[model samples]
Structures are given as structure tokens and as C-alpha cells.
Target: MPALRLLWLGCLGSLCRAYFDGPLQPEMSNGSLHHYFVPDGDYEENDDPERCQLLFRVSEPRRCGAAPGGLSLRQELTVLGRQVEDAGRVLESIGRSSSYDLDGEESYSQYLRREAAQIGDAYASSERALSELESKFRQGREPEPRDGARPGDACLGLLLRARALLR
Candidate 1:
């Protein structure tokens, strides 16, 4: 009975690998990367997104427009099976790496609880988003531009930055 329960928990945890935060917007433009040091809305005039330009900072390493880090969707789904085999191995490591989990015994416990709650919330949201995306993919629908330009073409130059973030 205990083993069966463990297996159930493992299966549930495996489902979570499909839920992940989407990728950050890839940097665009060539030449130096520009950014206004000021926070958004700090200056009314500087509020223009165009104001920001990539600056060549000697200390900060510039990232090339390469693929995103982490597993791709298929890869992640594949790993999900391994994780289901032993949720402890994956979940325990993730919990330990979190800062919340490192704040001493009491804090660690609190952190674990808090992080678990956060993960649950995030998982729900990701599931919903993924479902919508999957439907769109299956329908073979192209994103119509809200503006004149096509959807992601104007934004990230990729149809799905969210999908790219998976890799």
C-alpha cells in the first residue's frame, strides 16, 4: 500500500515537468546593447522603449543570440518519466537549491512550504497556457497580428518564445 501511494505521488510530480516558466524575451539588434539604467517610469521622457540601447559594458558579458538554456519540450517530457520514477531525487534537489530552503531549520521548513505553494500556483497557470498553445499548434493557426506585423514576428522573431524557453 505504501509503495502504491509513493507511485501515485511520483506520477503527479512527473506531470509538473510540463509546467515551466516561459522564456525571457531574446535580445534584439546588433551593435552595443543599450539600456537606460533608470527604472521604468523614472523619467517621463526616457519612458520611451526606444531610449534603451545596448551598451558595451566591459564587466558584463554580452550573450549571443543563441538557443535558450534547459531542456526542450520533448526532452522535458522525456525527463518527466525519469522524475516520476523517483520524485525525491528531483524535488529534493530543487528544494535544496532554493534560497528559501537554506535559511536554517525553521526557515528551511517555511521555505519549503512557501515554495511548494508557489509551485502549485505556477503549475496551474502553466497547464492552462500550455493547453491553449497546444490547441493552437494542432489547429495549424498562425497568429494574426494585433498590430500590422505578425504576432511574434514583431516581438521576439519567433512564433513561440514560450516554446523556445523550454530548450
Candidate 2:
């Protein structure tokens, strides 16, 4: 049951395969704590992750661009939150599968159990950031911190990933 708890809390660490690689960073609202990120339009440069650059500081949630798609940063934030929730479901399965191991070695099932716990912690942190960012974004206010902290010009953050790209 503790494993279940861990799975519920983690942020799906490095091994957690991505179910989405699209433009996770969308433009945010004015005075937002996020930035607008888009493919540098230099796809011929190989569409490398480095190509995902900050386009501009986000505006109000209502006016933010959605980067490559029609989805605004606000909407995309919702999508990201849903994705995190979905990953938790997969982590839950992993925790359940751990029940099959009869081995006692740390490299065995117990190792997986630990991973599950770690991911749960990560997920919990991510969930908090997501929810907080979303709520503040909707209200068109500067994020407090740990999640909604304002950006470069005090208006950049993809709510989640745009911060990296914005850099």
C-alpha cells in the first residue's frame, strides 16, 4: 500500500517515457509567470530540443499564443496536468506489478518499489506546480513561487516546460 502511495506522489522521473513531445510550452497571459515557446521555425535545423526557444514573454492568459498550435498556454497547461494524472495511472500499474517479485535483493522488485516511490514524490510536486500555475494563470496573476513564479520579464513560463525553452 505504501508503494501505491509512492506512485501517487512521484513526478515520473527520467525513465518515465514521455507520452507527449509536442509543443508542451504554450504562450501565457500578460503579467503571467510563464513564457511563450515555439519551434524556432528552423525545423531544418533538425527540430532539436534546442530549437525550442522562447518566442516572447507571455501576455494575459486570454491573449497568449499557443506556440505551434491553436491551443493557448492556458489550455495547454490543462493538457499537461491531464498528462501528469495519466502517468500516475501507469505508475500505479508499476506499483501493482511489484507485488510479483519474490526476490529480496535491492536490485530486484524492491528496487522497482523504490523507483515507484521516488516517482510518486516527483509526481506530487509536479501536480502541485501544475494546479497552482493553472489557477493563477486563469486569474491572470503572477504565480506565487515553487510553481507560479514570474518569468524573465516577469511574464514568461509555459506553465511547465516553457520555462526551460524560454531560457
Candidate 3:
């Protein structure tokens, strides 16, 4: 079972990397693949108190502009992918340990539950941020694609599968 879980995780990771790093579809493309470096001064000035608070709480902030709080779609998807990976690791650990008779099973189960909840919350928050950025693009608030790559359905599917494994 553990081997099967590891195999699944490996496949999911590959799919995530391919999808997140791949080119965007025609409708999602903004025709600008150039990298935008955040200016030092602008980074400091654009750090609004509210935005900082949101960043602290959620780790993903919805920004309609090229400000310090704004993260490219690729960046956001990368973060989501990492979260999913972490969750998968936790699930894998639980599976491996389930076969052994351990004294700390109860406590370990609690810890796993907390970790899973945290991962779920972070996933939802990042998902919301992605949706908001997409909406901004649709509304013309963001003229160019922050990054030419969009994770699209692949990342979300992986996240959902990971979450299911946790359960």
C-alpha cells in the first residue's frame, strides 16, 4: 500500500510540474512572457497594512496590481503544489505507520489531523487567490499575464486527490 501511495505521489508531482510549468492556452495567454522584477522601492511602498495582514494570515494574497502583495499565477500555483506535496507526505507517513503497533497512535493521529486541516485551509486560500487573479485578468484590471504558465485543472485535481488521501 505504501508503495502504491508513493507511486501515485510521484505521478502526481510530475503532472503538477508539467502543468504548472507549461505554456498557457490561447485564451489564458496575455502575449507577454517577459519576467517582471519587483522594484525594491516599490516593494516597500506597496506593502499596505491590510495586504500585509492578509499575507500573514493566508500566505496568499489577492492583488489586482503589480504590487508587493501580488504574486504571479505561477508563483501561487507553485505554492499550492508545495502544500499538496506536504500533505501527501503527511498522508504517506500515516500510511506507513498504520501497519505498526505504536504507543503514540492516538497522539500521532491528532497531529496528522491538525496538519491535514492546516493544509486544507492553505489550499482553499490559495485557490481563492488564484480565482481572484483570474477574475482580475478577465476584468482587464491586470493587462498582462503575470506569468505565461497557468496550472489550470491539473494542480486543483492533484490537490483534491491529496486531500482525499488525507481523509
Candidate 4:
């Protein structure tokens, strides 16, 4: 189970890198993109309230741009998709682990079921968000860059720490 989980995580990591780190397409270039970043009070200046809401929901309401991490909408969606995939793996691991039990406690099994359901809900939410963001990107809307670390920076650190611990 552990081996399978590790393999799944490795595949997911590679997929994320491939999807987000690919060469920038012509439509993704600076001039062709629409900026998500706006100075404070500048959101109101824009005519597209829906776009503002979609791009800025991941950010603090008061702030107009990406979080301190410079996470554009596309990158944020990718991170969210990665997180969903990870969570699905976790749920699958739990299910697989539970299946090995010859005489599992009913309460424990019930708990696992509930947890799996919750994870499913979360995964669905992440998928929906990713879909929405991708739709926006397909429409030529791009998240503006802001000052800070890149998206998934903390996740990378955590993954590295986990690898070290596993070793």
C-alpha cells in the first residue's frame, strides 16, 4: 500500500510539474493576458465584477492581487488540483489499509467511510475551482504577478521534508 501510495504521489508530482512548467504558449504571453492584479480600490474600477470575484477569491478580500506567493489563477488552480489528487490518494490508502483487516472494528470502519466521504466532497470542490479557473484562462484572462514566492513553494518544502522523513 505504501509503495503504491508513493508511486501515486510521484506520478501526481510529475503531472503537476509537466502541466504547469511547460513552455509558455503564445496566448499565455504577457501582452495577450488579462491581469488579475489591481491596486486597492482598483477592483471597483473594472467593469467585470465576475472576473474580479473569480480571480481574487483565493486572495484576501482586502487585497487586490495574488497572495504574497505570486500565485496566478492558473498556478493556484494547478496547486488545488494537485491537492485534490493527494487527498484522493490519502483516502484510497485509508480504504486499502482498512481492507487488510480481518476483523476491523465497526466504529473504525464507519469513521473511515465518513472521512472518505468528506475527502470526496473536498476533492469535488477543488475540481470545480480548477475547472472555473481554467475556463477563465481559456477566455484569455491571466492572473497578474505579485511580489512573493511562487505557487506551491510551501508544498514543495513539505514534500521534501516528508521524503527526508521517509528515508
Candidate 5:
């Protein structure tokens, strides 16, 4: 029928095709797509292992850091929990002597105790995950100095000085 012929002609007329004299992938060379990023050596730098390969659209193993971080907030909460426990322990210990001396001292004590309890609960909930991260972190942790002083000891010494300052 003329209607069917017209429809086919119209469809063919509306359709379009693109063509280029050069190759499909201009940047491609040596039959590898690496040409795209190879020009910018910054992205393909093999020396910096810390650089996230994901940014370069490259599939390579990367150290996400001391904590395995991908949508997991446990590591963040753990750090917060440690800070909370330390400060709360110091505050609660200091306030124990005269918890009733201040007007809101009772409420303060209750609040700190409740907060510490909550932190404990959080840790208990993520104990398994936290333990797994702990092992991985210990393995990835930087080697201690060959000298007599260890990095952890040095950090602890600094923390002790900071506590002394707080007192």
C-alpha cells in the first residue's frame, strides 16, 4: 500500500548515521585504552601507592587506610568512642570527689555515665567488625622505629603530657 511505502520512506529519511574518516578511538594506540590516561602521567603514577586508583578509572588494589572505609561508619564511631571514653573517664573521675558540690553536678555525672554506657553499647554491637579491622590495621600499621623508643610509646608519652596539661 502507498501508506506503508510512505511510512518506510519517512522513517528512512528521518534516520541519521554519523561517519568519521579517522579511527573510532583517536586516542587509542597499541590496541590499548591506556592511551587515554597514559598521556597524563600524574594519573598513572605507580610510585604513589596511596593515590586512589578509583579516581583514574583504573582497577588496582589500594590501601583504604588503617580502617577499611567504604560505607562503614564503625571506624569513625570507634575513634569517637575512644575520645569520649577518655574525656569522660577523666571528667567522671575528677567529679567523683564532689559530685554534689555543684548545682548541676548530679545531672552532669548522670549524663557522663549514660554517655559512657552508650559508647560501651556501641562497641559491643560492633565488636566483631571492630576486631576484624583491628587485625588488619595492626598488619598495615607502620613499622615501629628501630630505636629504643616505639611510635606507640612516643604517642602515649605525648598523650600523658596532654593529660598533665589538662589537669
Candidate 6:
């Protein structure tokens, strides 16, 4: 059973993998954490990840420009949590399918336990991220300057709120 436990725990590592692979840094709400990430198409000259040059910063509504299509740093982290949860599911299913092959039932049992823990952890992390995202949206709607901004801002904010819900 202890061996099985370890195996299960090992499987949970996949969650970590998924979390890291997804987005890490999200866009800032105020665009203070701003940098012109190359929009989906062509890579700019000398576009090094570490050397992304800053164009400018937004201090007011007009300066903010369009709602960033690129996911924000926070959003990227949330996406990672979702991916981790998905990986956990895959691992659980795999374990289920291989349950009878008791090369060592003990090891198998451990694997299952580990995978389950991973899923739970992933779920919790994702939920926390989603809650934060939801809060951000609600804050965005507080009858202020953002209220009169372009409709796109509202729509994107709503989309982000919904995406957080997906987890």
C-alpha cells in the first residue's frame, strides 16, 4: 500500500507539469505591466523573451488602448491550473484501466491515491484563481471610468470572468 501510495503521488506530478505549461504571467488590469507582445502572427526582430522592450505605460483611460488579446499574467496562471486538472483526470483514467494488472496492487493503489490528491490540489488552485479573476471583473464594473469605455472592454472582462468559471 505504501508503494502504491508513492506511485499515486508520482502521478500527481503531472498536475505540476500542466500548471507550468499554461500561462504564467497575465496582463495587468491597468496596463502598468505592459509590453507589446507580438500579436499571434510574425515574430518581431530580436524578440527575446527576457528582453521584451517596453513601449510605454497607460495612466488613464485613453492611454490603455484596446483590451489586451494576449492573456494577462494572472490569466496565464489560471490556465495552467486548468491544464493540471485535465492531466490529473487523464492519469486517474489510466490508473483505472490498469487496475487489474497487479504487478503489485500496492503500487497501483499508491498511484491512484496520489493522482486523486493531485486532482484535488489542482481543483483548489484553479478555483482560487477563478475567484480572484471574478473579483477583478466585479471591480472593473464599479460605475467608474471603465464603465464608459469601449464595449470591447466590457465584453473581454466578461469573457475572462467566464473563462475562470471553466475550471
Q: Write one digit per residue (lDDT tens) for candidate 4, span 1-167.
A: 99999999999999888675433333332324334544466656776655453221122343566767688888989999999999999999988787666245466767678778889999999999999999988877666656787888879999999999999
Each candidate structure's TM-score, on Cα atoms with residue i matched to residue i, is 0.22, 0.24, 0.23, 0.25, 0.17, 0.25
Worst 10 residues of 4 by lDDT: 53-62
Tens digits of per-residue lDDT for model 6, 59-156: 54333434667666678689989999999999998887777564445686787787788899999999999999999999988877655698689799
**What is the TM-score of candidate 3?**
0.23
Task: For residue 87, give model 6's deviation from the true position in Å.
Answer: 35
Residues 74-116, candidate 2: write the lDDT tens digits. Answer: 7889999999999999999887666556344445666678878
User: Candidate 1: which pairs clash?
Assistant: 32-54, 33-53, 33-54, 33-55, 34-53, 34-54, 34-55
In candidate 5, what are the lDDT values of residues 96-156, reduced to their tens digit? Answer: 7556544354576776787788899998979978899999999889675676876589789
lDDT string, candidate 1, 2-42, tens digits: 99999999999999977866543335434343555655645
Q: After superposition, how far is residue 148 of candidate 3 from its true place, in Å?
A: 99
List lDDT for all candidates, in order: 0.67, 0.64, 0.68, 0.72, 0.65, 0.73
After TM-score superposition, what is the CA distance of residue 19 in candidate 6 from its true location, in Å? 69
lDDT of 6 at 51: 57
> Candidates 4 and 5: which is better by lDDT?
4
Steric collisions counted per model: 7, 20, 0, 0, 0, 16
Kindly report which residue stretches of model 4 are placed more than 4 angstroms away from their true locations once superposed. 1-63, 67-69, 103-167
RMSD over all Cα atoms, model 6: 40.9
